[model samples]
Target: MIPLYLLHITTVEHSESLLWTFLTCNVFVVTAGIVFMYKLFTQKKVRGAGIVFGIAIAINYILIAIFGDPFDLLG
Candidate 1:
């Protein structure tokens, strides 16, 4: 994610196409993560790391939803 953010910061000024690509990929990845987590939850497979990951994703999603990008807060 940091690499993608860095790429965005570096290339966003040079290419609108890359910017759109980045947005599309980001959306796809986040959607995929959500679906995967839902499947894990439904299947009762959320073990130790899964529990940590799910909680982290949920917190980040909530923070981003309410605050309009809270990655800086995470840092």
Candidate 2:
């Protein structure tokens, strides 16, 4: 996602493509993290990985909200 964002910064066209790619990557990561956390919690196993992933996902969401959506640049 960072690499795509950097590439978008260098190119004037195809910004939408890059934005979609970035957003999709983020959504995939968050979804996977949630699923993993759920499985860990259900299995009664140590949740250290789950907690870390959860925190990372939360931070990602907060940063996106604060920084503004890349799609907004389409207008």
Candidate 3:
């Protein structure tokens, strides 16, 4: 996602494409993190991975907020 965002910064015309890909990647990561948490709490599975994913989710949110959404640049 960071790489795509960097590329998007360099390329002007393909901004939308990069933003879409970046957003998709972010959504996928966030979804996976939620799934991990659910499985960990409900099924008592993915013990170690669940913690890692939870941290990842937090970091992703922070970074996304700091960087700002690429889609916002479109308008």
Q: Which candidate is the best by lDDT?
A: 3
Candidate 2: C-alpha lDDT: 0.58
Model 1 CA lDDT for position 40: 79
Q: Encode model 3's per-residue lDDT on 1-75: one tens digit a residue.
A: 576565234233445664675566567666777788787778766877677777766655554454556553443
Task: For candidate 2, write residues 28-47 as lDDT tens digits.
Answer: 66676777768776885546
Query: What value does the lDDT take at residue 53 in candidate 2?
Result: 72
RMSD, every candidate, angstroms: 9.4, 7.8, 7.7
- Which prediction has more favorable lDDT, 1 or 3? 3
Please report the TM-score between candidate 1 and the true structure: 0.43
Lowest summed lDDT across 10 adjacent residues in model 1 is found at: 7-16
Clash-forming residue pairs, model 3: none
lDDT of 1 by residue, 23-60 (tens): 55456546657766786778855565465556656665
